[model samples]
Structure formats: structure tokens, C-alpha cells
Target: MLNGPLLVTERLILRPPAAEDFDAFAAMCTEEETMRFIGGACSRSAAWRQWCTLAGAWHIRGFSMFSVIERSTGEWVGRLGPWEPDGWPAPEVGYGVRASFAGKGYAFEGAVAACDFAIEFLKWPQLMHCIDPANTRSQALAKRLGAANAGATRLPPPFETAPVDAWTQSADQWRQKRKEF
Candidate 1:
């Protein structure tokens, strides 16, 4: 089993999701805008299942999204980290911040932490962001991270039909590009 580690960034703590984070997770997952890029807003029960799945991914694959906690307020602001499950096109350092947490650079900072963890701990050779084509914010973020749209790939159904872009960067590219961050 993989023990979650605390990843300290300048303004956030990237740690594994815990039982107590369910409420925050629920709030985020239930918001239409917050989930617009991923799946649409879902029921509370559905959110719980998603939360549990993220937590379970750590044990299953030795890596999963870290619950991004604001170090100052100690609130669970988002989820960001390494993610790769069966059927995924590639290993990814993904990030999703709550609606209120958006525009504060939490996603960027947390993703940087997660990327560091993915490279150092998970030892992935490359990383990808399975992004929706219409999500301009995510597109900008991916570009900022030096990830370019490498190709097209389908997500698992019912999202299979959604326009998914494969944004990617090699380990060496990250090492070179990360210097700017």
C-alpha cells in the first residue's frame, strides 16, 4: 500500500484525500462550473464515489490526486497530483481546484508539487493532461506547464465522445521548463 506523503508548496499542502475532506469534495463536485471541464455536477452520492475512487487509486496504482489544502486556512481547496488508471492513455499530473479557489494559482502551485512528486516518487517518464478542448482555462494552464497537445485520445464512456486533447511533456522537458516555475 502507498502511504500518502505531505507535499509542501509555497501556499498549499498536497496530501492524500482523507475522510474529512468529503464535505469539501462534495461541494466542489456538486458545482456545475467546477465540474464543467470534467464531468458535469453530480449527486452527493456520486461525489462520494468519486472521492473514494481517488483515495483508492493511491493503493491501486501507488499514485492519485492529492487533496490540495491551503496551508494558511487549512481548507481542502482542490485535488492535484499523479493519476493513471487502467485504460488511461498516459500517466498524468492532474489538477482541479474548487470554484472559490480558482484564480488564486492554487491549481498551478499544487500541480507543481504534484509534478515534483510524480517525477521523484512515481518515477513517471512523461506526464499528460487529458483536457477538454473547450476548457480554455485548462488549455492555458497546460500551456503554462509546457505541455503541448500531442494528439487526440478518447476517454472512457460516457465521456468517450467528448473532445479530449492529449497535452504532454517529457521528464526532460519538465526538468528544463520547470525552472521558470
Candidate 2:
């Protein structure tokens, strides 16, 4: 099942998502500010389906999104982990923090944990964090994870409305930069 409590950070716990987390995931995706850079609200059904797909990916490929939780309260802050987005050259690292939790370092905590997993566990040679140029916060987060500005790649035509720019991190690069943490 490739399932269990996988990794932990200073303030976050990375685990597989549970059914009860659907509501929080949907709400986080629907919030104005929380979702502003990622596109529009995702329907509740869509969110659950997405969550299932994330878990399914783990069984199928051995890696997928980790539901991020607050260690202190056990609250579902959001998700952070790795996935192979369609057309991406490598598994992309992505994350989202619940609206109320944004700006509180949860995203960074979860992201760093995911990056560590990608490097240490998955042993992926490369990772990407595609972002909208206007999404400075996410871009900065990518930078914090040791991803460099890799420039834009064409948005899959279906998502013509989405932004471009694929920030990339090599395993060697991550190992070097991660020492600072």
C-alpha cells in the first residue's frame, strides 16, 4: 500500500490522506486567497477524486502526495509531496496549506519534508515545482527547496489558463543546499 506515517518535520507530520480529510481539502482549494494562485475552486467531488488519485499513485508508482498535519493539534493543514504531473520531466513537488494556516510556515515545513523524501527515499534525480510567475510565495518556496529557475514550459494545452515556469531541483543540488537546514 506504500502507506503509513512516512516522514516528520519539526512542526509537521506527513502521512497518507484519509477520507475524513476530503472536506478540509476541498475547503482549502475553494478559499479565495489560498487558491488564488493555483486556479479556481475545486468541487468537493473533484477534491475527493483527486485525493483518491493521489493515494492510488502511491500504490501504482510508490510515491504520492503526503497529507500534511500539524503535529501539535493533529489538524489537516493541507498536502505536500511529490507527483508526476502530466508532461512533466520529473515528479513535481507541490503543496497547499489550509487558508487559516497560510503564512504560518506549514507549507515550508511540509515542502522541506517532501523534498527530503524525494531526495533520500525516492532517490529521484530531479524534481520540479511548476509555478505561476505571479505566485511569488510559491516561487520563493521552491527556491527554499533548492530549485532553480528553469524557465517556462508550455502549459499542457488543456490548462491553457494556467501559468508557466518549471523550477527544477537536482538530487545533487538538493543534497548540497539542504545542509543549511
Candidate 3:
């Protein structure tokens, strides 16, 4: 039930999650490959709780990952945006696009908008992308977004054992890189 500003890109719309976005969100959660680096696949009930967590974050923290939507077809593409739950290493602009929408650049497009929202609106001084060691695709994307590998770091509990590499860039760096796009 969170209604926040919609971040419109050329081919996608990033907005707060709604009740209608759940089924697709849950389906994405069940996709093993898609959820591999993102805490693994889960049951529909677990997805519900996870979805609620993201939705509730906006009300409590004033920001959360956005439910990505395709502009032309209005399909739920995936969820991607700012996320920094308790004990997180840093403010992050993370992303996950549905398997069907893979390679379409929706993640990159949405991430750019999300970074802008985070650095400009949310006023975060820096941004990080906590990518898993084996997630090469995300590493490439983070590189393409002008973030550099800042070395390894363990996440907080539940994910404390997860091997993660921190990719980061400063707000000034983001603004300069954004202008080049």
C-alpha cells in the first residue's frame, strides 16, 4: 500500500510495490537462476513475507526496492532499486530482472534511475552493490554503471556466510558518470 514517486525511464517504470505486483514477484522469487545470488528461491508464502518486507520498508525507511514495470506491455519486469535494511554494509542500488526479461537492459535502465533517486533525492553520499562472488553478470553490470570493486565483505546474519564483493562509487562520481550517459 505504499505510493511513492514513479521513476520513468525510456522503456520502464519504477514504482513502489502494490498488491497486484505480488504474483509476478512471487514467481520471480521461485526462479532458481534469478534468485540464486539473491538469497535463493523460496515458497510463495515466503515470497509474501519478503514482498511485505519491501513494501513496509518504504513506510518505515522512506525508500525501498521498486517493482519494475515494462512501459509498453505493463508487465511486471522485476524489482530493482535502493535497498538498505538493518545491518547492511552500505546504502545499495540493487537489481533483479525476471528471467524472461533478461538481456533487455531493463536492469541497467532501472538502476540508473534508482541511483539518481538515491544520490539526488535520498541524498546518500555513496552507493554500493553487494554482488556475490559468482555473479559475473551483475559484476559486469556494476562495472558498466561506473562502480568499482571495493573488495570483499560479509553481510549481516542470515547472509553472513554469503560471499559478497562490494562495488562502490561516490555521489560525485555517479553524477559525473550519469552526465556521460
Candidate 4:
């Protein structure tokens, strides 16, 4: 529905996911560790459907996660960017890096670039991250990004009952903390 800019970080390329990215996306989604907080690991077939849904979101909503790629290797590393499904509590900037790529600070780096896009193009007055309460790593990232816990929220459908903590801040807040984002 819309053509947005592709983002380039220090060592990564953030672009919309395509069929060619399925293998990498599937591998990550099927990994237990990667799927830890966002529902359990999914089967390859299930992952395919999920991957398709992500791509479809871009067409339908004009926005969704972008496939993160390694600049030097040209490999899909993960998906990260803005996501707000129906019934979502608020506009959110979400991310997930492949296990092998985890710990390299790519998530943070990618998120900064993604949040920049979300604020600039999406023009969301505010931003939020619906993080799992037990996901300490994400909690740390949220804090680092300058989003305070806005409180709990219920996700839509299947996982609605799960405990999700809302981390949010106004665009002005993000602008003040924009030095790093």
C-alpha cells in the first residue's frame, strides 16, 4: 500500500521481508530461545504462515516488522520495527534477533533505526513495547531506550491472558532521548 525507506544501521540493513527471507525467518521462529517470550517455538509450516502474515501486514496495514539483514553477509538476521495489530494497546516498536546474532547489540542498533522510522514516517504520537514480564533482556532494552513501564496490557486473541508489561513514552520523550535512538 505504501513504499517506505529502507533503513541502514552500522552493520545491518533493515528492509521489508520477502519470500527469499523465509528460511532465515523460519529458522529463528522455530528456535526455542528466540520464541521464548513470544509464544513457544512454532513448526516450520506454522512459521511459514506466520512469516506470510507479517508480509501480508505490510500490504494491508502499510507497516509491520522489517527483515533485519547483515550488511556484509546479506543474510536475514531477524525482524524488527513497528507493529500494531488490531486491539493492540498502542503503537509499538518490537524486535527479535537471531540466536547467533543475539548479544551483538544489533537489536538495540536496529531498534534505534526502526524507532526513528516509526516516529518520522509513521508519526505515531507515542511509542510502546509490549514486553513479556519475564523477559529481562527486553526489560533492560526498554529501559535503555528510555521507555518506562506504562503498566500491564492484554494482548489480542490466543495470548490475551498472558501478562504483558507495557513500556511507553511520548514522541517528545523519545525526541529528548533521541540522541541514542
Best by TM-score: 3
Q: Output the better candidate (1/3) by lDDT.
A: 3
- lDDT by residue for model 1 over 1-181, one digit each (tens)? 2267888888888888899889999999988998998788999999998999999998887779999899999998988888886777788888889999999988888887788788777788998999988899998998998899998898876677888899999988988989997
Q: Against the unseen true structure, what C-alpha lDDT does each candidate score?
A: 0.87, 0.80, 0.95, 0.87
Ranking by TM-score: 3, 1, 4, 2
Q: Each model's RMSD to truth, in Å? A: 1.5, 1.8, 0.8, 1.7
Stretches off by above 4 angstroms in model 3 are none
lDDT, model 3: 0.95
Q: Per-residue alpha-carbon lDDT of model 4 for 60-134, expressed as tens digits?
A: 889999999999999888998999888888878998988999998989989888888988889999889999989
Candidates 2 and 3 compared by lDDT, better number: 3
lDDT of 4: 0.87
Give the count of colliding residue pairs in each prediction: 0, 0, 0, 0
Which candidate has the top score in lDDT? 3
Clashing residue pairs in candidate 4 (N, C-alpha, C atoms within 3 angstroms): none
- TM-score of candidate 4 relative to the true fold: 0.95
Q: What is the C-alpha lDDT profile of model 2 across 33-150, one tens digit per residue?
A: 8877665567777777777888788778878888887889988998878888566545788888888898998898788788888878888888788788888999888888788888
lDDT of 3 by residue, 57-78 (tens): 9989999999999999999999
List candidate 1 stretches off by more than 4 Å: none
Estimated TM-score for each candidate:
0.96, 0.91, 0.98, 0.95
Candidate number with the higher TM-score (2 or 3): 3
